[model samples]
Target: MDPEILKFKILVLGDSGTGKTSIVRRIIRDEFSLVHSATVGVDFSVKVLNIAQGLEIRLQLWDLAGQDRFNHLSRLYYKQASGVLLVCDETKPDSLDSIVKWKGELDARLQYKIPAVLLVNKTDLIDDEDEGFSEDDLEKICSRLRIGSWSRTSAKDGFGVNECIKALVWDILSDKESKTPDPLTKTKDVFDWDDDCSSSIIRLGRQDLDLANSRGRARKCCH
Candidate 1:
């Protein structure tokens, strides 16, 4: 049996009502609901996978609230992420435009540069008459930002969702192999909780790891 790999963190970011949570739930549970309440501060899930390299990796995926009120809280989650999934609603042009700002925020807050994947979600909602954007437009935007890869998906229909994540995991692992010193091997001390219930808190790093593992399994199974 392969030694279990330490979990890696992946942040999912997008504007409000962009189906970030829906995509995650579909991948994690193989189930989807019409009603998914807005993420309060932050939420996470975990999945584990046994891949081709004799590696068992834990993927911790983080879903940060996209409301403006939570904008200030994003950096706290972005600080030590291993990768980022920048999701956009395919039906909303402005949501797509917001990727530029998201990229800037990641650059400013992260300690180390991390790979990013762009997901144009809700493709199922697009109509034949809607010609304002195309795969070419998304490609140009991703190329400009140097995103690792881009996927056009419909979270509602489960199209391209799995392929996008699998590509991301492969890219992350490949990037680690190409580096001189493995960037992801470093681990920090776990968080210490306060004795008082009112002061209790969960560590963001731990949440990140749990989500990555869960997302990784969703990807593998989807494939």
Candidate 2:
């Protein structure tokens, strides 16, 4: 049997020019671009991250467009997200304030709280230590959002890139661990699968089988 690999979908959300894409690139590619075009709809990338012990998580990172025109498309990507990184440009204080809108949208779509980390990006843009948002502001955000931690990251110089991602992954893992039940206790929602959802086992099985048959016929024709 193939080795089991845990997969988690993580969403990157922020306003335009907040460096959400740059942060993802820094984490997955370890490269930075001086000028990156604004994301249109959404971009996808995968990275294998080693967390605690020998466990590894395959992160499917989705970089959502920050433009208001594409706000309608956000739900399509966030529906399957396991965690979220709410990024903001440290230099542009306004960007930090806009995190409220991003967080609201995510909450409206998700209907339940998901593990999220607040990231202040572009720390390099600040020439002095006193230029960026104050600790009081960050504390207020954390308190209002009930966020456990926040980090300042610089996508250009690769500062705190790994740390931010690792923190998010840790939160995801911790959330999963808390949700798991002990051997003696029964699961809380065992009938979750019967929640009257359209994406049931029968539907998914038939869809997969149909696709496989279609591919098999194509292969036979090629032979």
Best by lDDT: 2
Error of 2 at 208 (Å): 42
Candidate 1 structure quality by residue, lDDT tens digits, 1-223: 5454756788998888889999788667656789779999888987565433234567788998888898878767886688888999877889989999888788888766788888878877766635435656766787787787777677787777766666666667656756847453322222222234221122122233221232122111111
Task: Please provide TM-scores, in order, for all candidate models, with all chains considered together.
Answer: 0.77, 0.78
Compared with the true structure, what per-residue lDDT tens digits does model 2 show for residues 104-162? 88888997778877777887787776788876687678668766567777889977666
Model 2 clash tally?
A: 0
List all candidate RMSDs to the true structure. Answer: 10.9, 16.6
Task: Give residue 24's error in model 1 in angstroms.
Answer: 1.0
Clashes of 1: 16
Clashes of each: 16, 0
lDDT of 2 at 165: 66
- Misplaced by over 4 Å in model 2 are 50-54, 182-223
The window of 10 residues in a row where model 2 has the poorest summed lDDT is: 214-223
